[model samples]
Target: MINQIYRLVSPGRFEITYRDMSLNGNKLVVRPKYLSVCAADQRYYQGRREASILQKKLPMALIHEGIGEVVFDPTNEFEIGQAVVMVPNTPTESDEVVEENYLPSSNFRSSGYDGFTQDYVFLNRDRVVPLFTELNNHTASFLELVSVSIHAIRRFKEKTHKRKETLGIWGDGNLGYITALLLRKMYPESTIVVFGKNDYKLDYFTFVDKKVLINDIPQDLNIDHAFECVGGRGSESAVDQIINCINPMGSVSLLGVSEEPIEVNTRLVLEKGLTLFGSSRSGTVDFQDAVNFLQQNKEVIDYLSQLVTNVIDVYSIKDIDSAFEEDLVSSWGKTVMEWKI
Candidate 1:
C-alpha cells in the first residue's frame, strides 16, 4: 500500500512524503477522519523547541490526537467502516507494574516517527477503540488527551488518601477544564475550585464549584488534592501554589509538560507529606476507559463540544498549514481539522 503522509519538514513548512506499506501484517489501516491540534503540535509547528530537538523530530507527521475510520482490517477484529479513536502510544515491552505509557521503550506518535497525518494510519490491533454514534467526532478527535486525563485521575485515585473533599485544579486551559469537569462528574460531592490568572479563560469553567484568580486565592482556602494543569513556565508557580494551599498529606497530580526542569519546594513538599505523581501519554487501556466513560456519560459529549474552537476542512497541504496557523492565534479550545486530505 502506498500511503501519503503530510510531514513537517521544517518550521512552518509541510511536505508530502510517500511510503510503501504492507497490508499483510497484523496491523489494520485506518483513514483519519478528524484530527485535533495540540499545544505540543504548535510548539513543533512554530519551532519553539530547542534547535537540536526540532532537528531530530521534524520531517515527521504532526498529529497524534485523531479519530479514524477502519478501511482495512487484516486482523479481522474491527469492522470495515467502523469509527474509532486511535491510541498514539506504541509499546515494545510489557511490564508487570509500570503502564505502557511510562515504559521507556514505548514509541508515541508525533514525537519521533509518523503520526495520523498519513493517508491511512496503520495501527496495532489494540490501538483502536470504537466510538458510539452519540459522541461527537470533533470532541472524539482529542480522545488521546482525554485518555491522558483519565490516566492521571486513575493514578491519583490510587495514590491519594480516602478524602477527596476539596479538589483544586490549577490553570484554566483545556486540560484543566477537562480534568475539573471529569472530577465534577466523578466526585459529585466534592467542591472543585479552578485557579488561574485569566478571568476570561477561567470563566469558561462555569461548571466548577468555584473559580479563583491565582493571585487572589483566599488565604484560608485549602484543598485535599490538586492537579497542576499549567505547563511551561507557569508550572513552577502552579506547583508552588499547590504546595502552599494543599492540606497536609494531600496528593498532587502533575499533568503538565515542561520543556526544562523547574525548581520545586522540596522542603515544603516533604514537610507537608505530599505525594506528587506525574502522568503523560496513555496506553490502550486508558483509551478504552475513556471510551467507556464517554459512552456511559452521554452528557459529557455536550460539554466537550464547547472546546471545539475551529473545525477546518483540509483537502490539501495548504489547508493543513492554515489550520495550524489559525490554531496558533486562537485564545482558547482545540482546533480540529476535518481530514479530507
Candidate 2:
C-alpha cells in the first residue's frame, strides 16, 4: 500500500511512498473508497499554520474526513464488503475534550497514521461505522461531517429558549447547509435564515428554510440563535455579525476552525447574557443518532450526493495539489479521492 505524508513547514510537494502492514492482531485492511479534502486540509497543505504548533505536530498525513469499504478484517463487527465511515478522532473518557462546549480531541486518525489516500488501509474495526444498505458510498463518505452538524443543532436545541426562535446561519458551505437542513427538521416551526458570500450558492438554497446574502440581514432581524461555519481570518467578522444579529440572550454555536484568532465583543456578550459554544465532532450518542437518521431517510442520501463536486482517483496522488487548487475558490461542496484496486 502507498501513503502520502504531509511534512509541515514545507510547501510545493508531497511525500508519497509505499508501505506494508500485515493485519496482525485485530487490525483490518480497508479499501479506500473516498477521501474528502476539507478546508483544514488545505490550510495544513499550504503551511499556513503556526510554526510552534506545526513543529509539535510535524510529519503527519493530511486527511481528516474519509470513508472506505472493508477489504480485510479480523474483528467480526464489520463484514468484508461492508461500507463504513471513518471517525477520525479517538477520544478517551478522561480527556477534557470540549473547547467552549465542543469536543477537541487530538487523536484524529489521518494526522497520526497513514491516511485514507491509499489503495488499502490498515485500521481497527472499532474505528469505523458500517454504512447501512440504504446509503451509497458517496453519501456514506460524508457521514462524519454530517454527524457533527447534526450534533451541533441538537446541542442548540438543548439550550433553546423557545419552541421556534428565529435562527440564523453565518455560512452557506456544506456544513452550514447540513446544519440548516437538520435545524429545519428539528424545529419545523422555526424560521431559519442562511447568510453567505456567494449568490449562486443561494440558487439551490431550497434545502434551508430561508436564504439571504450577507448584506441583506435585516436591521430588525434579531435571530434567537446563530451558527458560524466559515472559519478563517475574516471569520471574526462573521462572529460579530452573529452576535449583533441574535436577540438578547440568544446563543451562537462556533463550529468553524479559524486560522486566525477570533475577536468578539465581550461587553455585548455579557450585557446580552449570551451563550457561546464550540461544537465539533459528534459524541457517541450523536454518532448513533446520525446513523439512525441516515438509515431512516434514504431521500437525504440522494440530496447529499449533489454536494459532491469532484471524485478523483488516489492513483493520481501526485495530482492532489492540482485537485485542491482547482476547487479552492469555486467549490461549493466536497472534493474526494477514490482509491482503486
Best candidate, TM-score-wise?
1
- Candidate 1 regions with alpha-carbon error over 4 angstroms: none
**Cα lDDT of model 1 by residue, 21-71, tens digit:** 998879989999999999998899999999999988888999999999999
Candidate with maximal lDDT = 1
lDDT of 1 at 299: 88
lDDT (Cα, 0-100) at 172 in candidate 1? 91
In model 2, the runs with Cα more than 4 Å from the true position are 1-9, 18-22, 92-106, 112-114, 283-285
lDDT of 2 by residue, 1-341 (tens): 34333332244456655565555678777776777877766766766677775566655666667777787777576677877777666654334445321334346654544455555666655567766777766656677788888888777777867735688888878888788777777677888889988888876568676788887777877788889987776588889888888888888898988766767998899989899987777644565678888787766677777778877665554667666675576458887766552
Worst 10 residues of 1 by lDDT: 71-80
* Cand. 2 TM to true fold: 0.88
